[model samples]
Target: MKHDDYDNLNEGTRSRIRAKRRKTNLILNSLIVVVILLIGIVSFNIFFSNDEGAADQNGVVAEKDQDAASRDKKEDSKDAGKKEDSQESGKKEADESESEEEADEESAEEEELSDPIVTEGGSDANVKQTIENPEWKPVGTTQSGEHTTVFDQNAVDWQEMILAYSYATGIDKDNMTVWFNGNGGAPNTAVGTISEKGSDQTFRVWIEWVDGEGWKPVKVEELIQNDQKQS
Candidate 1:
C-alpha cells in the first residue's frame, strides 16, 4: 500500500539470509578438519605396525641361523672324534698283527733246530745205549784202514747219525772232524775222521746202505786206539 513499508521489509529479509550462510560455512570447515585428523592418525598406526613386524621377522631369522650354526659345529666335532677313534683302532690292530708274526717266526726256528734222533720210527733205547757206553763196536770193515757202522735203516737221517756218533764217541760236536763225501755213494753218508789225542781216526760210515755194499769196518784198531789215547 505504501513505499516506506515495502523498503523496511526488504532490508530485514536480506540481513537474516546473510547470517544463515555464515553459520553453514563454519560447520563445513569443522567437519573437514576432523576428517583430516582421523586420516593422519590411521596412517601413523599402520606405518608403526609394519615396522614392528619387520623387526620381529628379522629376529626370528637371526635365531634360526644361530641354531643352524650350532648344529653344524656339533656335527663337525662328532666327525673329528670318529676319525681319531678309527686311527687308534687301526694302530692297535697293526701292533697285534706284528706281534703275531714275530711269534710265528720264533716257533718255526725252534722246529728247525729240534733233535732229529727223536723221530717217530727210531727207538729211544738205541740212543740210551750210545749215551751209556761210549766204546760200542762197529759191525763192518773197509780197505782204507777206517772203521764203519751200518745204522738202522729206519733211522737214516744224517743229523741223527751225527748225534749217535757223537754220543758213542764221547766227542764234542764242535771239536769233531767232519768231511763231506760228494761221490754219491749213499744218501746221507759221510767219510770223515774224528781226531782224538792229536791223532786222526778215519771212518767211512754209511747213513743209508747202498746196493752190493753191505756193513763193513774201515779201521777198527785205529779208531779204538785214538779213543784210548784221549782217555
Candidate 2:
C-alpha cells in the first residue's frame, strides 16, 4: 500500500479505541455513585425507625407508671376514709358509755331514797309515830321542829330510845354520825340505833355510829353518857 493511505488507516483506529475507553469509564463512575446513594438512604431509614420505636416504648412506660400511681393514690384515700369512720365510731361508743354511767348513778340515788328497810326503832310504825309526834322531843335542843335530841329514859320509850338518840345527835338515817358521847358529863349523850321489823311481830335492830366512811354497830355493853352534871 502507499505511505499516505497507511497513515490514514492508523489514525482512524486510534480515534475509535479512545472513544470506547471513555464510554466504559463513564458507565463505571455512574454505577459507583448509585451504590453510595442507596447506602445513605438505607442508613437514614434505619436510624429514624430506631428512634421512633424508642420514643414509643418510653411513652408506654410513662403511661403505665402514671396508672400505677393513680391506683395507689385511690387506695390511700380509701384507707384514710376508713380510719376516720373508725374514729367516729369509737367516739360514739365512748359517749354512749358515759351516758349509761350517768343513768346508773341516778338510778342508785333513787334506790337509796325509796327502799326503806328499818330505822332506829323496832318497827316502821314505831318510827313513823315517833317522828310524827310533836311532843316526842329529842333530848339535845329545846327548839322542836325535827331538831336532834338526846335519848332520855323518861322522855322516850326504852325500845325506841335510838330514835330519840338519833334526833339529838343530828345523825341522818342514811349517813352515819360520830359518837362524841363517850366521855363523862357530855351533853346529850347516846349513840343512835338502826332497826328493822320482821314477820311474826319480831324485830331486828342495830345501834351504829359513823367512823370514817363506814357505819360501825355499837355493842350492847357500851355505856350511855349522862349529861346531868353538864345541866
Candidate 3:
C-alpha cells in the first residue's frame, strides 16, 4: 500500500485500541459502582436485620406483659390473704359462741339455787337458802358442866335447834360447832334436850362459817338463854 496510507492505518489502529481500553475501564462503570455498593451493603444488612428482629419481637411482648402484671399482682395478694383468713375465722367462731352462751347462763343460776327438801322416795333436797336463817351475833357466856352455854355466832348453817336437828333427825352434819342443852329446846336430835325454862328464858342458838366448802352454820340472837334443865 502507499506510505501515507500505511501510516494512517497504524494511527487508526492505535486510536481504536485506546478507545477499547477506555470503554473496558468504564467497564460497567466499575461494574456499576460495584453493583451499587452491593446494593448498599445488602440494603444495610436488610435494614439492620429488620431492626434486630423488631427489637426481639418487642422484647418478647414486653416480657409477656410483665409476666401478666406479675401474675395479677400475685393473684390479688392471694385473694386478699384468703379474705383476711376468712374474716378471722368468722370472728373466732363468733367469740366461741359468745363464751358458750355465758357459760350456759352461769349453769342456769346454779341450777336455780338447789335444795328443796324432800326425803327420798321420788327425791327432793332441802335447806340451803344460804343455810336457812343465817345472820346471828351475840357471843358470850359459858359454864359447861351444870349447863349454861349462852353463846352464838352465825353466817349460815346449823342453829335454831341445830337446824331442826339437821332436818328432823335425817342427820348428815358437816362443818359444825354447836352447843344446846337447855331453855326449852327441841328439834328431834333424838329428842333435842332442855327440860323447860320457856315463857321468857328463850334459847336455841349456835353457829359459824368459812365456806368454799368449809365451816358452816348460823342463826340466833333473839332473846337467848340456855341453862340445861337436862332431859
Candidate 4:
C-alpha cells in the first residue's frame, strides 16, 4: 500500500508537464514536414535532368540526319548538272555536223549549176563545104598561063559554077561577062566545044578586071571582101 501521489500534484506542476509535451510534439511535426519537402524537390530535379538529356540526344541525332540528307541532295544536284552539260555539248556537235552536211550539199548544187549545156549536131550547117557545080573545075590554061578555061556542058549549072569560082578565088563573079561568038569582044578565042557529063555543048567565057591586078580573061576565084580567100 505505498501509492505514488502523482495525481495529487499541484495544478501548476501538471500544467507545466502538459506544456512540455505539446512543445515536443510541435518540433517533431515541423521536422517531418521539412524532410518531405526536400524529398519532393530532389525527385523533381532527377526527372527533369533525365528528360533534358534524352531530348538533347534526340536533337543531335536529328541534326546529323538532316546534314546527311543535305549532302545527298547536293550530290544529286551536281549529278543532274553534269548530265545537262553533256547533253548540251552533244546537241552542239550534232548541230555542227548537220550544218557541214548542208554546206556540202549546197556546194554540190552550185557546181551542178555551173555546168554548160550541149546539144547534138543534127541540123549543123557545116554538112557540105563544096558547091554542086561541075563548071568550077579548070579544064585548060593558056600558053602564057594568064587565063584558065572553065567549061560546063550543062549551062544550067552556070550559077553554081560562078558561085564556086568566086568562093574558090575570092572574086566578084558578077562583074564578069560571057559571049558565044569569038569575034564578039576582046580576049575571045576559038577554043573547042565543051563536052562534059553528056550535057549540051556550049561556048562560054568570061572577062574580069580586078583591082590591084591586071585584066583577067578567065575566072577570078575570089574577091577581097569575101570570105573565100585562098589559103
Give the best candidate by lDDT: 1
Which of the two candidates, 1 or 3, achieves a greater TM-score against the reference? Answer: 3
- By lDDT, the candidates rank as 1, 2, 3, 4
Q: What's the C-alpha lDDT at position 222 in model 4?
A: 18
lDDT of 4 by residue, 1-231 (tens): 223465556666888998998998899999899999999999999999999999999999999999999999999999999999999999999999999999999898766534423222211232112112222333222134344333453442334344433333334556433322122133322221112223232223233323323223342211112111122
How many residue pairs in model 2 have overlapping backbones?
9
Prediction 3 TM-score vs. true: 0.41
How much lDDT does each candidate structure score?
Answer: 0.50, 0.48, 0.48, 0.47
170 Cα displacement, candidate 3 (Å)? 30
- Name model 4 segments beyond 4 Å from true: 1-21, 114-231
Order of the predicted models by TM-score, top scorer first? 2, 4, 3, 1
Q: Which residue pairs in model 2 clash with each other?
A: 138-149, 139-149, 139-150, 140-149, 140-150, 148-167, 148-168, 149-167, 149-168
Superior candidate under TM-score, 2 versus 4: 2
Q: List the residue pairs that clash in candidate 4.
A: 169-221, 169-222, 170-221, 170-222, 170-223, 171-221, 171-222, 171-223
Off by over 4 Å in 1: 1-16, 98-231
Q: Write the per-residue lDDT of candidate 1 for residues 72-107, one digit (tens) a residue.
A: 999999999999999999999999999999999978
